[model samples]
Target: MPRFSIVVPVYQVQGYLRACLESVLDQSYGDFELIVVDDCSPDGSPAILDEFAARDERVVPVHLPANGGIGPARNHGVRLARGEYLLFLDSDDSYTPGTLRAIAERIDATGRPDVVLFDYARTHWYGAVKRNRDAEVFGAAGAEVFTVAERPELLDLFTVVWNKAYRLDFFREGGFAFPTGFYEDAVVVYQTLWTARTITLVDRVCVYYRQRRRGNALRTPSREHFEVFAQYERLFRFIEERPELARWRGFLYDHMADHYLFILRQRDRVPPSSRPEFHRRAARDLRAHRPSGHRLGAHIPRTSFTLLSRAPYALYALHRVAAVKRAGLRRRHRVWRRRLRKVLLALHGRLVLRRALDPRLAVYSAFSHRGVLGDPAAIHRKAQEIAPHIRSVWVVGKDHVDALPPGVEHVLPGSRAYRRVTARATYLINNVNWANDLVKREGAVHIHTHQGTPLKSMGADLLKYPGARRGFSVPKMLRRADRWDYSLVANPHSELVWDRAYPCGFVSVRSGSPRNDCLVRPEPGRRESVRQRLGVPDDSTLILYAPTHRDHRQGGYAPTCDLERLVAGLPGDHVLAVRLHPSLARHHERGLGLRDLAERGLVLDVTDEPEVADLLLASDALITDYSSLMFDYAHLDRPVVLHTYDWDTYLAARGTYFDVTERPPGHVTRDEDELARLFASGAWCDEESTRLRSAFRARFGGYDDGRAAERVVRTLMLGEDMAAVPVVPAPGAPSDVLTRS
Candidate 1:
C-alpha cells in the first residue's frame, strides 16, 4: 500500500488542472498515488485527467458516469484510495511545494495521528495569495497533540476538508461519509473533529485554496447554498447522539448563529429573492437549538444579533443604506483629497518657489516616488560624475531614505523641501511625469527621460483604446507633454512615435537612454558579483524571463509561463532569471515566492534587484513580450525570444503600434512548448536569431553610443546643446547597422 493517497475531485477545472497535477507530481515526497475522480464535467477536464494518467502510472483517473457534486466525488475517491492515509485536494487548488514532505515528517514524529490539520493559502485569480491569519489556533494551546475539546477554535480555521489529512482506517471505522450537496465539508469536518481518537496540528501552509473569478459553487448563488441549514442540522444530530460530546453544544450553537448572520449579510451568496425565506429558516433553527448557556454577544454586537433575531427586516434595510452611504463617502473623500492636494501644491509652486528657480538645481524622480532607480538614477549618477557644480536632489519615499546612494541629497515626496525643489529646479528630470498640477516655471527646463521605448500605444493612442488610458485624461497627458523642454529618444522610430502620440513643442533628442550605458560597457567585476549573488554558475547560460504587464488584467498581469515546467524543460546548464513588472512583483512573490524557485535550483528572482542594467549585463539571452526591455537588451546583441502567449487578446486589449511578426527580433514562440523546444533544440541563438537581431538593431539601436548619459547630462544640467556635440557610433554595436531600414 502507498504511504499516502491524494484524492482530487475534478469538475470544470481545465484551465488549472495541469498546474494542480504538476504541483502534486513534483512534490518532494513523491511516494504517493494520485486518485483523480472525474465527475462527468461538461468541459475538457476528463481528457486532461486521462492525459496525466497516461504520462504517469502513479496517477489513476476514475471517470464517474453521472455528474455528482464535489462531496460525492470526494467520497468516491476515498472509497477507491489504497493508501494508509488519504489527503483530499480540490482539482482547482494545489499543494505547495514540499507540503507532503513536511506533513509526512510531522506525522511520523507524532506516531501517526488519526487526523492532521494544516493551514492553507487563499489564492485569488488576480495573483494575490493570502495566508490564514488565525495561526494561533493551529498551535493547539502549545501541545503537538490535542483534542477538539481542548482547542475548539480549530473549527473556525475554515471548515474546509482539503486543508487536512485523514488516516484511511480511522476514517473508515468512524463510519464517515459525505452527504450529497453544498456545505458537505462542514458536516464531515465537525463530526471527525468531535470524534477523532487522536488529533494533530501543523502550522505550515500545505494547501492553496483557490478563489476563481467564476464557476465556483460558493461564488455562484443558488438554492444549493440552502444546504448549509441541513448540514448544520446533521452536525447537531451527530453531537446529540454522542453524550461524551456534550461540552461542544454551546460553541456549536454560537457558530451556527454567526454563520446564519454571515449568510444573511452576504447579498451576493444569498439572493434578494431568497433572503426572507432563508432568514425565517435560520431563525427557526436558532430557536430549535438554543443551547442553555450559548451567547452570541461575545462573537457579534448585541444590538446587531438582537435585531437579526427579533427584527431582521429593519436591520437589512439599515445595512443597505449604510453600505451605499459608505461607498459614496469613500468616493467623495478620494476626489476631494486629490483636488485639495493639487490646489495646495499649485499654490506652493506659484507662491513660494517663484523666485527659487536656481540654475544649479536639478530635481529627479523615477516611476513617481518609487525609488532612486531607473532612467532617473542613471542620469542622476551621470550628472554627479560630469557636472559637479549642478546640485542634484532626489525625490524618494520616506521609508526608502536609508537605501539612497551615498552623497545624494534626498527629500521625501510632498515635504516642503520636495515641493520647493520640484517647483524651482532649473532642470526637472524624471522617467515619468510629476504630479498632475505641477506648474512648470517659464525659464525652468523640464526633461522627459521617458521610462522605456513603447511597443504598445501610448499618449494620444489612448483616444483610440480608452481602456489603456486607465483613468488619466488624454488632454491632461498632452498638456503635460506640452510643458516638456526636451524629451529623450532611443531611436528615430521612438522620436516619430513620441511626437505623434504626445504632440508637443518639446525638442526630441536622438540620444539613446542613459539606462543602457551600463549595458553597453559592462564592468566585469560587477557582472561577476551579480552572478555570484544570484547563485548562478559563471559558465551557465542565463536566460532572463521578463514579460510586460497586460493592461487588460485585473491587478496587472502575472507570469503566464509555467515557471516550474519551464525550468524542468530547459537544459541542465541553463538557468532562468525572472523579473516581474514592478506593479505585480509583490503579488507574484507572495503567490510563488523566490525560496521555492531557488530550492528547485532552476530560477533566480531578479525582480527586486537594484538595476535592470545589472540583470542585462549578467544575462546571455532574454525572453519577453512587448516590454521595452527588449530595446535595451538588444544592445547586447544576445538572443531574445518573444513569448506572445496572449498575442491576440493582448493586442485587442492594449493595441500595439508595430506588428511583432513583421519586424521581429530573435525568434517568437507563442506557447510554452514552442519556447521549451527552442531552448532544448539550441535554436535560440542561431543564425536566424542573429539576422533578426541585426534588423532589429538597424531600426531601434542607432542612437545608443555608450555616451547617452553624458550627452543627457551635458544638454540638461551643464547647459550644453546636444546639436553642438558630434554624433558617434555605438561603441559595441556593429558599424554597418543603420536606421530607416
Candidate 2:
C-alpha cells in the first residue's frame, strides 16, 4: 500500500510538464502513489499523464471533464487518492533532484506528523549564469517558522498548501474542500493549517517555480482586492457562523487589516472614476463586517473636515504622495550626482584621482575625440581578454589604474597623454570616444567599436562619424573621425541599423564589439550557483527592481502601489529586491521612505557593488522603470516591469528609440503599487514570454546571450569589420569576444 498520494494537478504546463513528471518519476524514494490530474489542459499535459499511467501501474491519471481551477481540480484528484498522506504539487512547478526522496526520508526519519512542509525555488528569466557573489540577488533564504499559534500577537499564518504534505486523516477531520474561485486555496489553507494537529517545516526547496512568465493567473489585478470589505464580509460571516472558532477574532482582525491595506494600495490601479465607489463599497463592507469594535474606518471617516480628518484612504493617499515628493527632493542630490558625474568623469577622468572602488571604464571611442571616455561592459571585458596578449598598452586618465583589471601596467593621459599611450601600445583600439589615427601615425590597427544602438543620430557624435567616409567639409572634424582605421558590427541587425544611422562613420566592418557583444555566451549554471550563495530558500522568487533615470533630470516620478493587492494576490513565497540605477543611488539614502523598505527586508540596493549582472543573475524577474537595462534583463527572458509614472514628460524629453510598450516587455505600472502587483507575477518560460522576448529583442542587437563579448572580440581581433555597438551594458560583466575572424 502506498504511504503517500502525491497529488500532481495539471493545467497548462506543456513545455515543463515532462520535466515536472520526470522529477516525480525519478524520485529515489518509491512506495508513493503518483496521482497526476489533468485539469483539461489544451496542451500536451494530458498526453504526458497518459504516458505516465501507461508505463507505471503506480501512476493514476485523473482527468476532469472541464477546466476547474487548481482547487476544484485538486479536490477531484484527491477523491481518487488511495494513500495515507496527501502531497499537492502544481503541474507547472517542478520537483528538484531528490526532492520527493528527501520528503520520504524526512517522513521515515521522524514518525510522520499531520503536516510536512518542504521548500521550493525560482528560475531567473535569463538562463542560469554565474554572478558576482556580492550582489545579493539570489541565494539561500531561511525557511518560515510555521508552528501552531505560538505568539499571541502573530497574525494568522500565510497558508501555502502546495508546500505542505498532510496526513489523509487531517483532511478527513476538518472536512477540507476548496472555496471555489480565485484565492480559494488561501481560504482552504487558512482553516487547514489552523486545524492541523502537528506540523513539520524543512528549509530545503523541492519545487522549481517558473517566474516572470508574461501571462500568469495572478498578473490580472482583481476587483476582489479593491472591493476589500465585501470579500472580508463573507469571510467574516463564515467566521461568525462558526461560533466554535469564536476566540480567533484577534487573528481575523489582523487579516482584515491586511485586506484593507492591500486594497488601499491599489487605489491607483482601479479606474479613477470607480475609486470613490470602490472606497465607499470598501467602507461599507468593513463597517458591516466586524470582529467587534476597533472600527478602523470609523476612527478616520465619521468626522472629517480637517487635513488629517479626511477619509483614511484619502489621507494615506495624500501622505504617500507627500512622502514620495519629500523623498524625491531629498534624494535629488544623489540623483543629480549620479547623472552629472558620468559626463564629468568622461571629461576630467584622465586628470582626476580615481576613487578606491571606481566602476567607470576608460574606453577608447572614435566618435568623441577630446577626453578619455567610457561606454559599456564590452570594452572592459574585451580589453581583459587581449590584455595579456599586448604588453605596455597605455592606460590614460587620473584613475585609469583603478579601472584596469589587475594585470596591465598603465600610463596616464594629459594633453600629450594620447601621444604617450599611443607611443607604447601595440593597438589603441577606439572603445569609447577617444580618437586614434593608427592608419596615419604608427601602423596601429584602430578598432572603432562605437557605443550605442544604430538607427538614428540625434547626438553630436553621430553627426561627426556618420560611418563610412562621407568626408566632412570641416577639416578638423574629418581628421578626428578618420582616426578610426577599422569598425565592427554584431550581426546583420547591427549592420542595417548602423547603415542608416552612421552613413559616413564606417571605415570597414568587423564582426566585433568588446563592449556590448559578450551577452550571448551560454551561462554555465550561474543561477543555481548564485542562489546557493545568496542563502535564499530554494523556493523564493528572486525579483530585481531596476528603474532607469528620468530624462527631465528632475522630480522623481511618483508611482502608486497596492500592498494589500500584492499580499492577497501574489504567491506567498516570493521576494522582491529593488535596485534603482546608480544615477539614483542617493535616492534611497536621502529619504527614510525607501531605506525603510529594507527594514521590511524586501528591497536591496546593489549600486554599491561593481557589477549589476550578479544581481541580475540572482533575480528571477526584473522589475524596472523606463531604462535600457530592461534590454539586459530581457536577454534573461525574465519578467520586466515598466514603472513609468511620468511617461508624458519622459517621452517629450527623450523619446524611446523604439516603441517600448507596443508588445510590452512586461506589465507597465504608472504607480508603485501596480508595479508591485506586476512584480508579484514572476518570470515566464512559456509561449507568452517567448513572444514578448522575441519581439523586444528584435529592436536591439541580439547580444543578450552571455557570450556577446566572445563574439565581438573574435570579430575585431582577426581584423574583421564591426558596425556601431549596442547600447553599453553595466560594468564588470562577462568578457566580450569577437570570435572566428
Candidate 3:
C-alpha cells in the first residue's frame, strides 16, 4: 500500500493543473497514490484529468458531473485515498521534492499528529515570493467542535488548503470537508489545530502556492471579505456548542479584532461618507468600540501639513520635489538643483523635435542610480529626465574610486579641498553601499537600489526582532536609504511596504536587475557555453553551495548542509561548485566539512568570483539558507537544496515575509545522512527530473532574455545621451574615491 494518499481537488484551474500534478508525482518520498476529483470544471481540466488517469495507475481521477465548489471535490478525493496519511494538494499549486518523504518520517517521529503543519509560500507577479514562517501543528476536529475566535494564527487558513498533511484516521473521524461554497481551509483550520494531541513544525519550507494574477481571489479584494461574518457566526456557535474551550477567552477578543480588520478593509472602498457609518456599525456590532490606532482615524489626515496642504499637486508633486532634493537627481555637476533642471530642459528641446517627427514617444525611466551614499533603493532613477546630456560627476568625498560606471571618471584621489565641484562633471551618483545616509532628511538626488533581497525583516528590521545585534540598525538604515532624491523600486506593493516602513519619495518601477537580469532568460545551452568558458567539465552536474557568515555564538545561525554526506552521496560525475558568500567565503575554519570535501576534490570554492549568476547558470542546483539569491534562481528552473540550520532564530529575527510551503524549489535537510539519501534516488530519476524541471518553470518562467542590458543602455544612458553634465566634486565619496588627481 502507498504510504500516503494525495487528495487533489480539480476545479476551473485547468491553467495550472499539469504542473500541480507533476509536483505530486515527482515527490522524492514516492510511496503515494494520487486521488483527483474533478468537480465539473468549465475549462478543459477534465480532458487533462482523463489523460492523467489513463497514463498512471497511481492516479485515480473521479469526474463529478456537476460543479460543487472545492470542498466537495476534496471530500470525494479523501474518501478514495488508500494511504494511512492523507495529503491534500491544490490543483493550482505544487509540492517540493521529498515533501511527503520528510513529512511521513516526521509523522512517525512525532507520534502521529492529527495534522502536520508546515510552512507555505506564494510568489507575486508569478515571481518574487512572500513567505510566512510560523506554519503550525493542527489537528482534525469537527468544524463545529472548535472555535477559531480563540486562535488568531489559524486565521491564515484564510488563504490556502494544501499547506499540510494529515492522518487519514483523524480526518475520517472528524468528517471534515471544505466548506461548500466559501473558503474550505478557514472552516477547518481552527477546529483541526485545537484537536491535535501532538503537532510538529518542520523547520523546512515545503510547499509552493502559485498565485494566479488575473482573478480576484484576494488581490483588489471585494465583497468576499464579508464571508467571514457568516464564518465567524458559525465559530461562535461552535464554541458555544463545545463549552470546553471557555478557558481560552483571549481568542475571542483576537478573532473579534481580526474580523473587524477584515470588515473595515471592505468599507474603505465604499467612499468616506459610507465608511464612517459602516465602521461605526463594525465597532458597535463586531468589537463594540470605536476604531483607533495607526491604520485608521476619522480625524487624522495621512500627509504632513507642510507638504500636503502647502505643496504643489500635493502628494505627487511633493514626492517629485523630495526625490530631486533628497536624492540630488541632476547628473550635471552644478551645485544648484535649479541650474541643473534648467540644463536638462534645454536638452529636452532636441527630443521635442524627435517627438514631433515620431508621435510614438515616451520618456524612459532610469532603472539604476548609485544610492549607496544614502538610501539603498532610493537611488535617483530619472536623473536624465532632469539633466539630459549630463554625464560624469564628482564625488562628495574620497571612498568611491572604483565603484563608478566604466568610462565615467569617478573622483580625483587625494582631494579633501575640492569642496565646490562646479565644473568637474555631471551627476555625482552614490552606489548603494558607499556612504550610507538613510534619513529622507537629506536634500540630494541620490538614488538607491538595495544590494540584496529578503523581504520580511533581515537587514532593515534588525533592531526590531530578537537577533538584531548582528544585523544593521533599522531606523538608521531606513534614514540612510531615505536620503535618496528618488528611488528605483521593484513593484508597487514593494513601494507600499517600503513607504510604510520609511519615508515616501519618487519611485522608478523596475521588474528585475540591470546587472544579473540574464539569469531569468533561457540560455538555450548557454549554460553549456558558460561551462566551457569557465573551463568546467561538460558531463558533470554542478551544485553551487554558498552560505553567508554571521557571528555564530551571538548569531545562533550556523551552516546546516551535510557536506560529508553531500560529497559522498553525489554521483561521481557530479561536481560540487561550492561558492560561499564573499563575506564568509574565506577558508577561516581549518577543517570545515565543506573544506574537507574540497580537499577530497569533490567540490571547488568560487565565492570570490565577481558575480554568482554565470556560475548559477552553468550549475544544475544551488544550496543555501536565508539568502535572497535563491528567489532569483527560482526563475532558473533548477533544483535547490536548503541548508537552514538556524531556522527558528532566523524567523524570529526576520519574519517569513512570504509563505514557505509554497516556494521552496528543492528538498530542505538538516544533516548528511538525509541529504545523502535524497540525492541518491529521491530526485534523480528520469520522470522525477521531468517533474522537477516542469514544476519549476511553470511558476518562475524560463529566461532573462539578455535584453536588459540593451534596455538599460537605451533607457538610462545612450538613448538619453546622458553625457553632458559638468562634474561636482566632493571629498571621500565611495563612487568618487579619487579617480582624477
Tens-digit lDDT track of model 2 for 1-741: 687888887887887778777878887667788888888889888998898899888889888889877778888867887788888877766666556655665666557777776555455456331112221211224323334554222123334577678888778676777655556655666666566656555445566656645646544555534533443554565667777666665566556655544544453345555555655665555455455655443333232212222365576557657866877987997889878976664545433322221112232422233222323345545556654343334444553346545654445554445444453343455655343332234444555566534422223333443332133333454455555555565444454454444345445343433333323442577667766765567888776666655434433333324333443455767766666555454441212224334433445545544446667777877666566566555666666666667766655555544556565676666765665555445433345656776666664444433444544444444334433343333333224423221
* Tens digit per residue, CA lDDT, model 3, 183-283: 45666666666555545544334667677767645444355444554565565556667677553334543555555544443434334344444344444
- Computed on alpha carbons, the lDDT of every model, listed in order, comes to 0.81, 0.55, 0.53
TM-score of each: 0.68, 0.42, 0.44
Q: Please give the lDDT score at residue 591 for candidate 2.
A: 26
- Work out how many backbone clashes candidate 3 has: 100
Model 3: lDDT to the true structure:
0.53
Task: Tell me the deviation in Å of residue 352 in model 1.
Answer: 4.1
Q: Which numbered prediction scores highest in TM-score against the true structure?
A: 1
Clashing pairs in 1: none
| Cα lDDT of model 1 by residue, 1-741, tens digit | 988999999888899999999999999788899999999998999999999999999999999999988889988988988998989988889988778877787789778999998877788887667667675465345677777777777777788888888999989999888998888888889889988877897666678888888777775667777888998898889889999998788878888888877777675687778877787788788788988866664866465456556666657559657866988999999999999988886777678755857888889888877778887788888888888788999888876678777877888887888878878788888888777657788799888888878889988887888667786888987888788888887776777788888888887776688888888777669888888888888989899988888777665764477777777878889899988887765553333344345534558877777678889888899999889999999889899999898889888888988998578888999888998888888999999999999989877886777788888888667768666544464434334322221
Q: Runs in model 2 with CA error above 4 Å?
A: 128-146, 151-159, 221-248, 263-278, 289-334, 337-741
Relative to the unseen true structure, what is the C-alpha lDDT of residue 362 in candidate 1, on a scale of 0 to 100? 88
**What TM value does model 3 have?**
0.44
Give lDDT for model 1.
0.81
Top of the candidates by lDDT: 1
Using lDDT as the measure, name the better of candidate 1 and candidate 3.
1
